[model samples]
Target: MTLLAPQPFRPKSAQLLSGLMFCWVLLSSAACQEDGASVNCTANPEQCGIDVEAVPARLYVDPPFGLGFGCVLMGCDEAKILTLENRGGGQLAITSVRFKEGSSEDFSFALYNDEEDPADEALEHPTIEKPLKIKDSRTKALSVTYKPTDGIADEAVLIIDAHDASLPYQDSVLTTVEVPLRSRVLGSVAFVPSTDTINFGYVAPDETGQAILTLENTSENDAVLTLAALNLTDENDAFAFTFPENPHANPGDVIEVALSFTPSEYQDYEGQLTVATNDTAQPLIAVDLRGTAFSEPGIRITPSVGQGIDFGAVRFGETDVWELQLYNAGGAPLTVTPSISALGDTDPNVFHMGSTSGEALAEIAPLESTVLSVYATPAGGGAQEGVLQLETTDPNNPLITVTLAVFGNAPMAEYSIEDIDFGNVVMGWQSDVVEVTIGNTGTGDLTIFSYDFEIGSSPQIMLGSAPDLPVKISPDDDPISFAFFLNGQSLGPANATFLLQTDAIDYSTARLDLTGQVVSCIDGCPVANGTPSCEAGYCAIGSCAEGYHDTNVAFADGCECQEERNGDDIGGNCSDKRDLGNLGDDCSDHAHSVTVTGNLHDAEDTDLYYVKMEDAGSVICDTFGDSFRAKVELISAPPGLALCVNIRASGSGCGGYTDYYDPSYCGQNSYSSNGSWSSDDDKEVVAWVVWKPDATPICTNYQIKFRADD
Candidate 1:
């Protein structure tokens, strides 16, 4: 410092800074040493330098990413600056500078007398005329200044590449600058009750409740918030908002969304709230609310159609009620009105929960249930049908459906034939066959048990089949058919009667009346009803016709027989039937009758008697009177006409009679006489009638005439 060395401006400290000029000394030394002897500095390049080092270059930009600084509110301008410094002990060369659309423009830069200025054309660029000199301890800077195109978001990158001229060949160093975007601020908004789910206890129908929604701004930047809409899904309600700007929220501020639910008679409420904002990061925020608003106490009835209940078959003058329970699951009271409905028609005010005139049911509280009675009455025994429907309003899940059932009765079943007919049966034959068909038109089953008619008993009729039978049949099925056989003897159809009986009870009066007739005939000749033909012995009834006579001989045809017969006749109406005196009508010419009075002893010879006839050969009568031999006061005398008689018991001689006369009734009959005139010859009375001839007789008479013995 004592006087700057004028000797080439060299100082002793300059030798201490020799490392800083290492690159310059190597280049100068190589040229000086290569005059004749080669210093070989370029060959041994690593040993040619004095260890000179270059400072690292650094870049500075106005804003790191070139985001427009505060331009969103103040309308930014291009006031940013970019600089490059020579941190090394060498010069830096800037070969070219490039500019693009939306790039940092309207700017100028100077590097060692090299300058760049704005051009008239957009996206303009100019190559540098000289290398840039970024001296040590001196920084090179480029200035950029312009009015923003519009919003300043149409920004681009600025590239600055530097070359180090101290190296063998210049190497490039690249650095970039960016311009970012900015936004506006309106208000802040957020979900107050951040949770998405809400719960409300049981509420009655037509009841009102409030759902509160709170909003807050958690964003650091101010935001523009707007309440978009309060949307309801699957809801039935007419809603009004009380708070004006509730859904609109502000940043770092709290706002409330007043949710009002006014439900119809019996319903629940559900809705959603959406908030719109200007923040790009978060555009819209959504908040949903769900609550229950109770309705008035009114009957809400629902009827069902059970599968097993058939409506078309109900009884006449009958009513059926399917009770449906309506519950108030809201917080307020409710009212219910019950009614009946058909497909095309509805019955007004038929069923009432409380009052039929006014509101039927009322004051139904929370968690309370009531029954709605729906009456479906059938007017007559005819097929009828319909349904029942109830109308109500609910915000969410409003309409519920059920089925209705109605019914009527069908007609009763009748029969076609009441009685069974057993055509024709034989006699002494049992179990004859009969058939019948029973029909049913009713809805139920018809069971027939042991209902049959019985045939009465006769010698010609024998019942061999049971009169009881049973069968079961449904209405839709064909009529039950019964077939049976009877075996019995039959005179005629009229002679048999069917005794109708059921089970063991005897109801034999149900009978078919009949009569029988049997006639005899011989070779086409009619005989008496009960008599048989003489030779053929054949009899048949229901065959005889017109007048007929009886011929009592073989081959005797009554129509071809003679009309009269000649015979010896008795004077005063002698009948063809013979009559004896005491034998009454059964005697013939070979017939006789006898009466005797006598006293007989066993000690008499055999007697014989001869009959005196009015006609010589035809003896109409033969009998003997008693004879006596006795004296009163004088000596004994012989009998008048020693009467003897013999009796005949049978045959033509005896006239078919059994006589009681004794053997003494024969006259002029001797014990040993065999002559035709002797009493002994005709003394066969004892042999003819009396088996005991040796017995004593007290008196004698011809044919039992009394004879006294003295």
Candidate 2:
């Protein structure tokens, strides 16, 4: 083919075109050369344009250019097959294609064609495959699988240092493709609750409740869910909150939390719970806790019946004590107020045992009870009754009352003389009479329908006159009478006693007995039978004739008068002495010098009567040695005198006795010693005595003579 085939010179336009073309070709070829080799080019600007800027080698990915999730596999997961197209204007030569050091284990790739397979050592330099050529505008596919560590970034860059033999080393291009670190996240997040809410109703200050949250795994993989926050609130200051457990959540995990609320100074309340977690878009979980709050329950009282007390069947002014009990059964403490009131016509102040109205009585804790006392005192004397009412706020059981009873005054009996005495009555004397007044001075009625006169071995005595038999006395009425009679025999100075009885009185009967007596002789004088004791040893049987020895002597002795002396019985010594004043031997002779003496002290006074009677000794003598005369003397006289006597003579066989007369002048005349005897003649002195009694002697000058002596 050495034939110089077309040396034929052409036109100048073609040559000029060739010269310009040659110059253009040279510059254009220089622009097209990678290292030093020529490249086919055209002189047209559009065809042979020179671009100095490095254009990144790109891929037209037909298959999975973007990262995708992987199916779950053994230890972890993997992601997919991918393809790339060489769409740049130049042929590409990939020298090394690999991931960075830390990212190398995250991916693996397989060439789409056998010729595109990079040698194993290609990853040593620039960390990729060995150098490989790809024609311009060609497609190169790969199967790329990748797996990323959990909780790490999911993307990485695959770097390829491409070199062309026609270009310099610095002129070679480096290509990188962003490949997502793929993972198979096969789980979703959900919220779970062990319980919705906890209601602690009517609780004390120290109480607690527990709530649990669970993070459930709906997929095949474990999930990490985080808790952001937790909240609790209440309506009043009555409640507070606390958390005793952690707020973390994991897939298929449950967390138990304790919530506590303490009520402070409040009655009722409501509370809520809020929990926030990272698993859901709206992470807050709300729970409502509710219950009724109570303080303590108290007892309210209202009396059962009338307020004014009427103690039925009870006497007035009677007092009774009652009781009331109350309880607090609620969860809190209760304060109680106890009051006393009388219902109906009764006065409030009439019946009272407890504190006043609105007085706080006691404070009771939960399940505690207390008792109160109420006193009811009536006002009047008849049957008094009323009701005791208690007031409180308890709606169910409000009021209460208690019945009262009181017994008042009863009647008692009274009598006049508690003691009586019967003197010198004979033994078995049955006609001894004494009167006792029975009266009922009290407000109650008394009855004395029968009369009973009880006596010791005496006949049944009549309380009234003889034949009337018995008497009935009434309250506040007059006195009653009774009599006992002697048994017609010798019932004398010794064995004398009796008692009067009553049927209505319950106590012992009224009785009388002798408590005193007198002896036959006095002042060292010999006494005989039926003889009165000598009055100062100066009394005898006969009368004291005119001008007798002393004016006190009852009789004259032998008519021989003795000389008189001025001495009187001073100091009561009864001895004759020469020391005598002008005092006369009269009753005034015993008086002191001055009736009103030194200091004028009062003298004890005594009034007495004594009988001096003639005995058998005087009768046998036929002379007047003993006499029957009652001596009237002043022991200690109170400026006066009282004289009276009733004597009975005991004669032998009821016949032999002394005949006596009542003598008028036993001593000096009744007037004085200086005066004459009111009787002048010698009267028949039988047995006689004179007295200054209002009952003068029946015989003014008579004396007794013993018939036994005759």
Candidate 3:
């Protein structure tokens, strides 16, 4: 083995000067060579040692740790580039790049001169055949490619030898540079929902309800999510969603969406809520949104007075009508069926449902009401009770019952007069008649038993005419009349009680008070001093005393002024008949005959006589003719009596009989035998006539005898 020595060190300027001195010494070396035969040899090997300094190469990696391929899905490729720069003034040569001990298969790397190629296959523990050299301040790229077969966290280390040379004789050890590489392999982009389905249990048709659905981003990194569409599968459009405007979320972030359900009908409804998103695993998510729409009906009764229907105090055979209100207080339409019936002894026909047909159905909308009419007509008197049943489609209460009641009574007789006043009457005179009317105001018929003055009453007041007793009066019919008269006999004030008895229970006895005063006549007759006499509540007088007449029919005015008659004998008797020449006397008594004389002035100037008969009887008349043709007429005879006979001749004739006669009552009393006469030129002839009776009695008759004059 040869011993190695270091080379001699010399300054550049000193080396040049040494070279010149060597040349000069060679030129003078021949002349001084004979004298320098004896030159000394003092050059020592230890003193001529050479000094040599060694510096190691430095490698600077832009990233001390390898670049990170953040995250990649399985079977997908991602890459990152790392730079190696030579910071020292020496060549940085990479001999081999190798993974660390615990490196992953999913993490790999590659080296390139100018650019990075991510698609290139990565090498593990790879040795460079030719050393890669890098200059100072220059960079070299190492591309890290990650292709994950499975989802897991992985790391690797890429070691670079900067001092390694291509020749085996060169130095192989230098500064070691390490670049750490890391990669995370993700499975896939996923969207996880908080709930898979939303259920809105029950909702009303008129109302709306809502629910919330959360969409969470299950991806490991931030992701841009897109809400492509939101759809409702309900045909009725009852379900919907309130979509978010920006549908972006980071890892573990959540996006909330609102789901609403609205119903329109009264039946059950079903629907689905669909959401479209950008998630790779689940692009379109369908959330089952279920809801049911239901209806509840309610019944209510509103009566006229109380909670129940009541027809109070109705008369028998009369009807009373009322109204009841039904309300729908729920969210849906209500159907109602109304019926009415008597509960106990009352008749079924008494209670009736009006405004609706038999068993008719009624529909009421939500929060609305309907009115039903009811009528109560009692057939008999007394208390009546009934029930009104209403059936509806309400879930809570299907059947509703209401009580009804009514009271009825018999017809009542109402009197128009509470009292009667005859006013003042003179002595020996009578007062005017006062009338009292009785009306049946109740629902039934009323019968009057009797109407008369009370027993043991004063003679001053008496009944004018007896009214027919046991008479029937119908409800709302014309009233019955009763009259009373006052006789001016008593002194001072005279009082009498007129009592009415009826069949009606409510009006068993009705009494009216008659009051009058006996007054002394002012202008009538002389007063009796010794023995004062009063007759019929009036002062005794022989005839009508003076100017005062009983105009008011009060006895106080004894002699009333003669009322103007106008040819109508309203209150006149036979003795006071008017128009004596042209008209005959009106008979006051059917049993008595009156003689009336009249002259026939012309053919049209005939006389007429009237007889009001109380019993069936014949009327006899005789006419004395003067100069004109006379005609005798007996009209309006009794049913069996013949009509009046008329005789006509040049002068006079008196033996004319009725052609048709059937006198069966008195066999010998023939109508022909009663009349026979002859006509005379200048003498007066007397004509006689008689009327017979019929089966039934007659009340009125008329007779006339006249002459036809030229």
Candidate 4:
């Protein structure tokens, strides 16, 4: 009565077997069924009609489980292929292929429809919204790339979503797959240069010249450079190189190297400069160097013919010429050309130059010579100088100059005797002859016509002897002599001049001064108040008498004073007596006795008297004075005469002391009137006054009394 609902569809064989088994099992268990439970197919599977099965989805990657891009340099990119296969026998749908969580920024993923050329079928965008379909036993490709900005190891994974069409009945189901990616970034180094050669131009020997070489680094990292060795073909080690110490350069950095060249000889020089670095492409770099050395010329000049050429002195309007030689003492030829055109004053009249061939240029070969003539004509009288300049081709000295000097003089004449002096001449006498030397002290000759006294010259001055008239004296000649005399009758100084006529242009008539002094007869005599007599143009004087002296230096005063007895005043009232000891004189008279009165001014005063006794008698001589101490000395008379004296001290005011000639005549009777007269000659007696040096002036009167004993 209850019909069973249709069971799930199943295979025919399985359904038939399952139906038979179910009928038998139902007969066996019929008694166990309850009366109210009819055939219930919902709860019991044996009552079902058929059975159905569902399909499952599966995912497989072509590279199994991972993908890698290998190691690469920084700033470079690498790519790899990732494949997903549908192995579950159904249409596979990929919804998206993207980077998973915890993935790095250096990794990327993209989907491609083409299996053979995955790069050609890359998706425009990295993420995909439309699902991709893959049939059973088919595969899909994904493009994965790794790029880094820094040097580091990187790893990432790609996530894929795959769906199965057979499992469409189910919801929220997917096949998830991951493909791992990894990579490593590395640093690169390189080196480059701006140039590879250096050239040093012409350089002098032993002098250094330099050039520069530049180097650069083209790598993305830092690098170091070092110089190894610099080789040169120099015997004297003339080439050199200067490099930095352990140079470290960064990216895009440039360095400079200085290379110098110095040659020892005059020749061409060549060398190489090498630089080493840590570049992989090029480890060593070489630079070529070249230079040249040359020699220079020198110049020297000297006098050709002699030490120097002198033009001497010439007239103002005259011209003088001189010659000088130019010699080349160098290894090269010396070329000379006149530079007269450059002179500010190139007057041909003042200085003129001429060559042997009259050429403007002069060339002297090595060890050869040439002549240079110079003429100078002064414009006026005096010293003049000029210069001659020449230009040459020598490197050391390019210009040569010579100096010329000349003197211009006018006609002139001079005398060696400017003045003449006849010192002193006595009246009525001729002076000693004085010679005057006349010479030509000028540059020209002196022609003398005549010589005479000047108009104002005294008539007593005359030229006694001279050179003949019309005499010529050349320059620098020995002077000639001329004698002159001075005779006058007057007593005074006299001056005159002697005029000489000459042919000199400057001095037509030269005058020479003559000076002299005339002295009178009294002045010419040697003794004062002496009788002067003219003898042979000189005055002679007689000798002076005794007891008289001339104290005045002037000739006008004759014998002026009587001789004093001592340096101090011997006060005596004696007359001026100049008589010699003649028989007729006052002191020599033997007929009478002599008596005199005098005064003693000081102790040093002395008085002298003369006496003569005809017949021997008592000769008594006595001296009396007041406030005076007198000392008397009596000289012994002749052989036929005898004398005596008496000595005594009167008082404290005055005293008298006598000195006898002999002790036998000392007594009072010593002068007895007993001898006869032998000769009528006078005898001398002296008296002295005694006083102290400090005594005041005192005038003491004294008297000498003389009497013949009768």
Q: By lDDT, is 2 or 4 better?
A: 4
- Candidate 2: C-alpha RMSD after superposition: 38.7
Put the candidates in TM-score order, highest first: 4, 3, 1, 2
What would the per-residue lDDT of candidate 1 be over residues 595-630, giving only the tens digit for each residue?
Answer: 332221223222222232111111232222111111
Best by the lDDT measure:
3
Summarize candidate 4's per-residue lDDT along 578-627 as a digit string, tens digits.
Answer: 11121112222343333344443333433433332332222331112111
lDDT of 4 at 294: 36
**How many clashes show up in model 2?**
59
Assess candidate 3 and give its TM-score to the true structure. Answer: 0.25
| Clashing pairs in model 4, backbone N/Cα/C closer than 3 A | 7-49, 7-50, 8-50, 8-51, 429-537
Model 2 segments beyond 4 Å from truth? 1-64, 70-76, 79-169, 180-190, 198-211, 217-273, 277-282, 288-710
lDDT of 1 at 5: 10
Please identify model 3 stretches exceeding 4 Å from their true place.
1-294, 304-307, 355-358, 414-532, 535-710
Q: Scored by CA lDDT, what does every candidate get? A: 0.37, 0.39, 0.55, 0.53
* Candidate 4's TM-score: 0.26
